[model samples]
Structure formats: structure tokens, C-alpha cells
Target: MKKIVSLYSVAILLIIGSCSTNPFTGKKTLALVSNDQLFPMAFQQYGQFLTENKVVVGTAEAKRVEKVGMKIKAAAERWLTANGQAAVLQGYQWEYKLVDNKEVNAWCMPGGKIVFYTGILPITNDEATMAAVMGHEVAHALASHGAQRMSAGMLQQAGAVAVSVGTQNQSAEKQQMWMQAFGLGSQFGVMLPFSRDHESEADMIGLTLMAVAGYDPKNAVIVWERMSAKGGGQAPPEFMSTHPSNETRIAKITSQIPAAKAEAAKFGVVFK
Candidate 1:
């Protein structure tokens, strides 16, 4: 019994130590891998991806990607620097590429690598809307959602191993069912919900960043309206899906508009 208790205590410590706090949200977040370890891997993988893909250079779309990305990154730098957390990006190699893909998507990798697909341009429409989207992607990187996802998966695997060991003498079929149950439970409960939280946080932060960067925050709501319309007459409900854009989110943004406007003011921004 004493041995089992000690093992459980160690497990809890591992869990706590694996987490990092979000400076923006003041929330503890899972990050099994530290940036010291993760950033190098992310940077190398980003380099490899750029090399393998048809990375557009000295093109209109490429220029736009870099323009919007730099603004958002500058805003992030200001926020981080003001908060005295400049060391968070000590080895950051910020690169923005506009890949020639029509997937209508964009993403930012850890350590400040970002990509925007060309197809997303139509919906993004203008610089402000583009800022909104880029801000959202940049926010994801700052929030470390990918790192958090990896941490959650690792924790789930660890828990499964612990359960299997604890019930080793049980039937194999029972153990298998337990494993499956654990997997699904982890996905639907911890992983999916955390993913949504990250998206929402990104939306909030992105809204403010774009506004500060002299882009209208109202375009954020419009972007989501278009995103919801893209659901193709069938979606698993915003609450059920990973990306949410139903009325609730729109309403939330509307509610936060005043504050976003205030943030923009600090940067000498006034919506046009």
C-alpha cells in the first residue's frame, strides 16, 4: 500500500512539473516538453517543411503573408517585452511563408514560423481581415496549443500504462476495453475541450492584436460569419466541433469589442 501511494505521488509531481503557465491567461497549461527542448525540434521541422514544399518567394501573396505576420509578431514582441518575458523567444527564428495551397487555412509553428495558404485570401478579403486570421494563428503559437496537445497525449499514454500495470492480472479483453475507453475518454474530454479553449483564447488575443496593429476588430466577427457559412450546410455544431463559430462566439466578440477598441487606442489605432 505504501509503495502504491509513493508511485501515485510521483505521478502527480510529474504531471505538475510538465505544465507551464500562460502569461496572457494566467492559466496553468500542459507542456510536457519545455521550449528549450521543443523549439529546436519545431524550428528544424519548419525548415525541412519549407524546403520540401513549393515555398513562394518574392510574390504578391508571399509579401502579404510576411507583412501581416511581421505586424502580428511585432505586436506580440511588444506585449511580451512589456511583460518582461523577452527570454521566451530567445532562439525564435521568425519566418512567414505563403505557400501556394488552396486549403483556406493558415498555421504558426512554435518559435515564430508561420504559413498562410493562398486560397484563404478570398475570405480574408482585405488587410484587416488578413490581420485577424494571422493574429489568430500567431496566438495559437503563443498559447502553445501544439505543445499542450502533445503533453495531453503523453499523459493519456502514461495513464493507460499505469492502469494496465495495476490490472495486469485481469483478462486481456478487459484490459483492451479499458485502454479503448481511456483513449476515447481522453480525446473527448481533455483533448477536444482544451483545443476549443485554445481557439477561443486565440480569437480573443488575436482580436486585440489585430486591433492594435491598426486593423478593425469588427472584421473578426465577419471572418467568423464567413467561416460558419463554410460549414457546407452540415457541421457538428460549434460546441461539438474543434473550431467554433456559432452565434455564441460572435456574441462574445461583440461583447469584447469595447476592450479591443481600447487596446487599439494604445497603439494609435482608430478603425476606418
Candidate 2:
């Protein structure tokens, strides 16, 4: 009993000591891993991935990716500066690449390394839609979702350890049952919901960034609509998945457009 109490006390101290505020949301977030430690590793891995993959260069499509990415990056800067949070982007080294893979995905790594797979271009169809995707990916990096995820994983592991120690005296069968229940409960109840919240936050931030960059925020909804149709009704339930359902995403984005446009108007961008 004392050992379990000590373990939990340590976990609580760790959580309290390892938190940072999210500049965009002004919310306290876990920061067990700092950007100082995470960015160099991310840059190295990004370099390695680029070397291993077929990176399309000098093509119109590739240039388009770079162009859109730069616009989004600038938009982030503008928003941060306007909000007096320009320091939030310090130490970020932004790079964008288009990979010739057939996966309909794009992602931004820590410190602004970004990749757009060729497979998603068809759905993007135009610069506006592409900006929507780019903005979303960029928002993930800016919001430090990667760092938060790592921190969350560390806490989950700590919880598993606590569970194990708390059940050490139980019978082997009962111990296994307890561990299984912990796994299911933590994954379904905690981790998946945490990820979904990140996705929704990114959606809102990305919409504002794209709007400020002079892209129509409404295209964000359109992009998701196309994405939903492309999925062909195959996504798992929202509670079981890391992303909100497409219908949820579309509705949420639609509702947030007015606010995004208002934000963009601060930078003299007006949408009709």
C-alpha cells in the first residue's frame, strides 16, 4: 500500500512539474519532453525519411506543396505575432516536401517539417483545398501535438506500472485480468479521447491560419467532405479512433468558419 501511494505521489509531482501552456489555446499542456530535446531528433528523422523515399522535386505539384506550406507557415507567424505569442515559434526550422507515395495523408513533424503524399493531391484538387490540408498539418506541429502525445504516452506507462504494482499480490489470473482491464480502459477511455481533442483543436487552429493566409475557410469543410466520401464509410467509431468522425469534423468546421473569418479580418483578409 505504501509503495503504491509513493508511486502515485511521484506521478502527480511529475505532472505538476512538467507542464507548459499552449500559446494558441492558452491551456496548460503536458511537456514531459521539451522542444529542445524533440526537435533535433525530429529533424534527423525527417532527413532520413526524405533520403529513403522518392521525394518529387522540380515538378509543378511539388512546387505547389512548398508554396502552400510557406503560406501556412506565414499565417501561423502572423497569428502568433498578433496575439503577442511570437516567441512560441522560436527555434522552428520549417521545411516542406512532397513525397511520391500513394497514401492519402499529410503530416507535420515537430519544428515544422512537413510532407504531403501524392495520393492526397487528387482529393485536394486545388490550392484552396490543399491549403486546408496544409493548415491542418501545420497546426499539429504548432500546437505541439507530438510532444503532448509523447507526454501522454509516458503517463499511460506510469499508470500501467502503478496498476501492476497494486496488483502484485493478487493471483496470476486475477493479475492478468486487472492488467487487461487497465489496458482497455486507458486506451478507450483516456488515450483515444485525448487524441480526438487534439484533432479538433488542430481543426480550429488550421481553419484560422488558412483563413488568415487568404484561403477561404469554407474550403476546409469541402476538403473534409471529399475526405469523408473517399473513406466510403469505413472509419471506425469516434470513440475507438484517434480522429473525430468525418461528419463531426465537417459540422465542427462549418460552425467555426464565422469565427475564423473574423480572426482573418484582423489581418485584413475578408471572406464573402
Candidate 3:
């Protein structure tokens, strides 16, 4: 019991000590791992990924990916500067690459390293739609969601340890049952919701970012519409998934378009 109490106390203190406010959302988040520590590792991993993949360079599609990524990066910088959060991106080493892969996906690693798989370009047929996806990916890095995820994972692991320690005096069968319960509870009840919230937050931030980058905010909805159409198969229920359902995302993005456009107007980027 004392061990369990001590573990809980340490976890609580870690949470309190590591809290940082997200510049875009103004919400406090766990950041137990500092970017100074995380960025170097992320940069190295990105380098290794590029070394292993067939990077498409010196092509129209590759140039488009770099062009759109730069626009989104500049827009993020401008918005952060205007909002007095420029320091949040101080360690970012921005790089954009197009890799020859069949998976329709793109991602931004911590410290602004972005990769676009060639397969996704068919869906992002133009600059505006590409900006939408780039903005979303970049927003994930900007918000420090990766660090937050690591912090949460640490907490979940600590919770598991606490369960084991607390149940040590009980029967082996009882301890095993509690461990299984802890695993399921932490994953479904905590981690999944946490990840989905991050996705939704990225969507909101991405809409404003694409608008600030001179892309029509409403096109974000169109981008997602294309995404949904391409996904002819079914997805797991939203409760068990890491992303919001397509219908939920479309509705949210459509409703937020007016506000995103207004945000862009502050930066002298007006949409017709």
C-alpha cells in the first residue's frame, strides 16, 4: 500500500511539474520530455528514414510537396509570431521530402521534418489540398503532441507497475487479473481518447494554418471529402480508433471554416 501511494504521488508530481500550455489551444499539456531532448532523436530518426526510403527529388510532384510544405511552415511562423509564441518553434529544423511509396499518407516528425508519400498526391491533386494536409501534419509537431504522447505512455507504464506492486500480496490469479484490467483500462479509456483529441486539435489548427498560408479554408472540407471517398472500406468504431470518424471530421471542419478565415484575415490573407 505504501509503494502504491508513493507511486501515485510521484506520478502526480511529474504531471504537475511537466505541464506546458499549448500556444494554439492555450490548453495545458503534459510535456515530461523536453523538445531539447526529443528533437535530436526525432531528427536522427528522420534521417534514418530518408536513408532507407526512395526519396523522389527533382520532379514536379516533389517540388510541389516542398512548395506546399514551405508555405505551411511560413504561415505557422507568421501566426506564432503574431500570437507571441514564436519561441515555441525555435528548435525546428524544417525539411520536406517526397518518398516513392504507395501508401497514401504524410507525416511531420518533431522539429519540423516532414515526409509525403507519393501515393497521397493523387488525393491532394492541387496546391490548396496539399496545403490542407501539410498544415495538419505540421500542427501535430507544433502542438508537441509527440512529447505529450510519450509522457502519457510513461504514466500508463507507471500505473501498470503500481498495479503489480499493489497486488503482490494477493493471490497470483488475482494479480494477473488486475494486470489485464489495467492494460485494457489504460489503452481504451485513456490512451485512445487522448490520441483522438490530438487528431481533432490538429484538424482545428490545420484549418487556420492553411487559411493563413493563402489556401481557401473551405478546401479543407473538400480535402477530407476526397479522403473519405477514397476510403471505400469501413473503419473501426470511433471509440476504438485514433481519429475521429469521417463524418465527424467533415462537420467540424465545415463549421470552423468561418473562424479560420477570420484568423487568416488578421495576417492580411483574405479568401474570396
What CA root-mean-square deviation does each model show from the true structure?
A: 2.3, 1.0, 1.0
- Tens-digit lDDT track for model 2 on 8-86? 8999999999999988899999999999999999999999999999999999999999999999999999999989999
Give the lDDT of residue 149 in candidate 3: 93
lDDT of 3 by residue, 1-272 (tens): 68888999999998999999999989999999999999999999999999999999999999999999999999999999999999998899999999999998999898899999999999888999999899999999999999999999999999999999999999999999999999999999999999999999999999999999999988889888888898974778999998888889999999999999999999898878
lDDT of 1 by residue, 8-117 (tens): 67778988877788866778988788777878999999989888888888977678878988898888787777777666657677888888787978888887788888
Give the total clashing residue pairs for model 1. Answer: 0
List TM-scores for all candidates, in order: 0.90, 0.98, 0.97
Cα error, residue 169 of model 1, in Å, equals 1.2
Summed over model 2, clashes come to 0
**Candidate 3: C-alpha lDDT:** 0.93
Instruction: List lDDT for all candidates, in order.
Output: 0.79, 0.93, 0.93
Kindly give the stretch of ten consecutive residues in candidate 3 with the minimal lDDT sum.
Answer: 226-235
